[model samples]
Target chain A: MTASPDQIVVRDALKTYGTGAAEVTALAHVDLTVDRGQFVSIIGPSGCGKSTLLRLVAGLETADSGDVTVFGADPDQACAAKMIGFVPQVPALLPWLSVEGNVTLPSKVNRRADALRRTLPGHVHREPADPRALLTKIGLGDSLARLPHQLSGGMQQRVAIARAFAIQADVLLMDEPFSALDEFTREAIQVQLLELWEQMRTTVVFVTHSVSEAVVLSDKVVVMSARPGRIDAVIDIDLPRPRRQGLLESAAVHDYEDLIRGRLQTAWAAGPATR
Target chain B: MTDTTDTDQTGAAPTGATPTGAAVADTALATAATAAAASVRRRQPSRSLLRPTIWLPAVGALIVAGVLWEIVAINNTYLLPRLGMIGQAIVTQPSFYLENAGVTLSEALVGLVIGFVAAVLVAVLVTESGILRRAIMPLAVVLNVTPVVAIAPALVVAFGFGPAPKLIVTALITFFPILMNVITGLNSVSPPILQVFATLRASRFEVLTRLRLPSSLTFVFAALKVVFPLSIVGAVVAEFSAPGAAKGLGTVISVASSNSRLAVVYAAILCLAIMGSVLLFLVTLLEKRVLRWHESQRLLRG
Candidate 1:
């Protein structure tokens, strides 16, 4: 194992969509590095390219001009190796699959497609720790037999969370996962998220519009500007967990929230394309 | 279910329920009017418990019609052919009707399988590649637009008057809905759900196998429910065109028509209806079994 404290490094990243007259620059010279085990949440308005940034790191999209290295390796290459685990906004569990099958999905997707493929089944598509144990870790032990449709929205997302952990990836990326959920479910999942993070400390880069969510779940919140999305400010959250909504009741949390919203509001108002 | 309806009622209250309830009420009214009309003509299945009641009246009507036919045809044996005469023919020539029915059913089953498989392959290929989608979609539409009647003779000539022509017809007719619905289902992956897969470092194969295929299953099966019967119809019609030469009820019906075996034709027609119903029923069974996880199935199960 490489002894490295920094897992992600993005240098002068540029992302442009379309070409010529129709060309729109989504990201411009975005330079970011996330340290190992750091819980970073990128907060911004819609169209702020926070999702684009995460996608850039996840290898879901390519940067026109930049290098992104995760775990001291190329992000896409590491992802292909099953080095990064992603938990998206809506739980995209296979509907035909039961909860157990959904969680085991990543494991079934072969990591080594060439050379060792025939012999790669055991390590690549693992039936490691019983699904029960993995589900228990994410507060979803009882849902293994249920399908996604049978579960509530929050429950479904939790299963998504369980699947990500089940993959045993070293890094995790979540993008506005709780935005559509109700307040109670969001908070409950947030608490569960912290517990999961504590157990695995996988370098995480979460994107969210909710300032309070960023303040509650993140170690550092990267507030961003609109349109040509860029990091406006980075606020460190030192609140201790097992976290509760009471943390937000504190003046410090509100101050952070206030700071983020103030930055976002100013950024939002100054944009040609409303964020 | 009650809780959900209550929640919806309270949340949306006036507008949403009004429109939805109006639609439901309109459907209910139409069904009621249809049942009433059927009942006036005969007896209808009015009670939910009387599902048998619905068919009973229709059978009674058929029997009444048959008696009238027997009365009318008692004098001229050429037209209706006495009911007793037909019954005698059915009893004595059980093999004739049974054999033709079996042949037709088998042809339908083969065509259904071929069509289903072809549709699924087309759906998967088109979903995966945009160029393939652009290329293959128009071909599918052109096939759909080509009338079965117009193509039946060509198919018979090209494939010979064997099961090949009939199977081709069925496969052609049944391929559209399954392909269309499955494509829609596969592409229906919500952005949020896709984001979850991305975060997990889930491979393309993982996303496709786990998310795309499974999610599209309900849509696929829904298409099958419609297409299976169409396949049966397509196959039978093609066989009818090929008459006496092809192994199907359609051949029997055509031969019977020329021979003036009117009772035999009716028997063949009944068998055709049964075959269509059975194929549709089989698809329904598969849907219920496979998509027990789908929301529609969950609501039904609940």
Candidate 2:
């Protein structure tokens, strides 16, 4: 069978914060691509610019140079088209809005995005999931009227996840969505996320610090180094589907973990790359 | 609620694993219902001021203060009027004090409404444009620092013995705090949420209505609590300073004190105190109702 089309593409993308003596490169000449329906995780140590890369893809920040595209359009165009979904590290749910209100917020906004999409010749179109149904699938069905603070951290992130999915965007960019959660909660939410992703088949670019988390949730794990945040290696997980709790202890998963860990160590030791 | 929750769960249950899934969902729902019931019970007590936790000590302290004032006034009759004498004076001509209070209260209310609207409009403009913020904020600060009470005679001289000067003074006194607080509240949104709105491509209007304005309610209420009582003070001060002003609580105090009617003077001051407290209380009640979802209100309840 022919391969799926490229849904996201980033070429030589560079991003920096501050200026002069305080200048710090967040993403340096970052090049990456995510195919349609693929689950890719950008895994690295802290300060590795994975979140910056996600932000760039989400069109929340601009790259200093190079190209970033979603569905062959600029990130801003994709954002305006409502083709990009983002889940921040913190849930970032609007405090005043109830869970249902928060989940359904995207529906109330970006009507112009649809009109813009209609102007395009070839555009990705998918059915937006009902917010209530998505909430139920994520085990927060009864909390529709509850405020964001009324819910636990895990539950709030679940709402965030549901909200991101409710938009039915072409690509989902998550920045450490589960890193704040406890291990059990994270794993459980990971399974719930995978179940949702399996049904929607939306291209996902997730950022995380966990090795096994990156392996289990993503088809391809991108390992990045710090100081000058750039891709160190990209490892393909050939493991079978339904990668549940039991898969974490499996020998093949451990092998992939070891390989990623070893590369991460070398990346950690590399320090700032000399010109 | 439980029935609705059960129906939702049953409807969501898959086709094949009906028995076990239904049992699990039932158990989960039962636990959730218990927790919800417990939370509801915990939050059941109304926050009305009549509640013993608030009013019991309030009444007790008020009685003790009244007795202490009576004792002090017995020794120093020249300065402090006895509580009973003040009460007698008020009862002797209740309509006189009431009419003057009515005039003062009307001035304060009208000025307060004008001030709030003007402050909110200017706040929106200030937040929308940096140039406006720079131009308007300093002028507001200048107005705030230049004692509005000191300007009452000038307003009276210019405007000619009318209510316009008193209303203008009250509005000026009440404007700055609300403007400052509103500016703070509008800018109080966290960066990540702003980013989320940006990603959603929400229009400026949507961002203002759905995000900025809702978040600013707490700050607005806080400013209102201070400025509501200050509005009354402003109107009274204007009446005291404006030479031609003949009918207000402040004028009653000025005339009675000059005539050595200490009881009447104390009575007018007492009326002003009660009016100020009532305005503050009304503001608080409105705050509680509007900010039920806010963290500050939740913390107060517990």
Candidate 3:
């Protein structure tokens, strides 16, 4: 059963802070929808409620007014049903476990270790490959037995991403999982993530401030505005899949990049006057 | 780098404080006057195997002090005795002092164990509830403030001259620091660490086990170091206050003091010293075994 049109629907979703004097509108009267299997990126500057939006989709927080649904079910219900996987920016692996153990934890947690076993590729199955193969896709194979400290910054975040995928969830919600990495590592991970997305065809709602990253990764970039963060534009990137570092040099990616930068600057300019 | 040249020429790191410590001063003078010297390699952190060096010097210093006292009191056997005389008393009266030492050590150990268990449980409770902390913190203040000397008499009168009073007194004496340190340790999970756990939706127990407990081990062991001597002091005070008590090291010392058996008194004192050192040693060893991944313990590894 592949994805259809009305996959994740948000209707009149409101998240307001305190009332009257203490009032703050975090996500005000937002309404948008991403089709099933759509790779969407919600890109905006800091405090544009990008994180608040992702948290809503992940079912980590509730909407104050309206609805958020995943695969025709409520976000929270669908999440509990193991329909979503989240990779927070921080490396959230339990420090006590090895990398392989951390990657396999989500499976073990759900009484679904057999899923990881079945998902193992033939070349991986023959040689007793580590579950680290998933992590290795993100370039952390050398650290199977290593703890979090032993690995560098980019490597630990790779483990966190692998752990998310191992659970075999349909949706991947990432919150700028590579902002902390160096430029070289960040680009490398972005390319590798594209490869995983092409193969899995899973929907992703990536939250990021980097316009270039959003342009490179998403099929649709849903640009957000300031304060009571509402959608400004939903720019589509119809570029081909398995795109390379060379693709970043292409006119298509740059065209989308300029378009998002223009929209974000306008949002930023209007932001201060309202205050 | 040339940034290290001054330190390299001096062959010693400068003092961390405003003034130089003896270790640094000794290094500079000793180095400047000499050459072909081996570098001071930050003292390759002493392992459990190497830790005995710390005790050896202290014991040696004690022995030297005892010898000097014996030399001064060669004729006056009442106030002080010869080092040889104390050694003879310990060896010849093996059944006499050893039994008493054993009795005192056992009571101290039992008190420490009971006190430790009670302290940990209360610490966990206090950490969980502000109400419980408010209720118990005052009680802990009372326990800490009430000296063993004053309370030992009442404990002895209640539990009598047996090991019961001695164990109870010691337990009360050793409980406060252990409880306070443990409570602080249990609640010491940095907010960031807890947030990581919570965002992962890790269970509260998992958070406690992996994060909180690992952090608490160091503090708990520090409390153990403080409480070890307290255990012995408690046992001794309990016995000393109840002079009617027999079969304790304190009883041996009290009797020896009255009869002017100076060698026996010195022998009992030696036993107490040995007991304190051994208990502290065991706790340190346990800390190393349990927390090999700890930063302090990892530094100690090399």
Q: Please, what are the lDDT tens digits per residue for candidate 2 over residues B110-215?
A: 9988998999999989998999989988888889899887898888888866799889989998999999999899988888788887888988888888888889
* lDDT (0 to 1) per candidate: 0.73, 0.83, 0.72
- Which is the leading candidate under DockQ? 2
What TM-score does the predicted chain A of each candidate obtain versus native chain A? 0.89, 0.94, 0.88
TM-score of each: 0.80, 0.90, 0.76
Over 4 Å off, model 2: A1-5, A273-275, B1-56
Count of backbone clashes, every candidate in sequence: 7, 0, 0
Tens digits of per-residue lDDT for model 1, B1-302: 34334433333333222222222213334234323332432321133225554367778998999778778988887876676766777788888788877877777778878888888888989988999989999989998888887898888888787788888888788878888998898887777667656644556777787778877887887887888778768877898778647457888878888989888876777777877788788878888888766667644432
Error of 2 at B256 (Å): 1.9
Kindly indicate the candidate among 1 and 3 with the higher TM-score: 1
Model 1: lDDT of residue B35: 37
Candidate 1 per-residue C-alpha lDDT over A1-275 given as tens digits, one digit per residue, 9 for 90 to 100: 34232557778889988889777668878877788778999988777778888888888888999888776657656666676778777777777778898887677665563223223222233334465687877766655775665455666777877887776666788878887676767777888888887876667889998888898888898887766777777778887766776666899888888888887887777776632
Residue A103's lDDT within candidate 2 is 91
User: In CAPRI terms, where does candidate 2 land?
Assistant: acceptable
Best candidate (score: lDDT): 2
- Residue pairs clashing, model 2: none
For candidate 1, report its TM-score.
Answer: 0.80
DockQ of each: 0.23, 0.30, 0.07
lDDT of 3 by residue, B1-302 (tens): 34234334443322111011122212234223222212322333333225555467878998898778867888676677778878998889788877888999899999999999999989877887799999989988987897778988887788787778888898898899899898888887765345434434555566666667766877899999999988999989888988998789998899889998778898999889988999899999898777654546533332
Q: lDDT at B255 for candidate 2?
A: 85
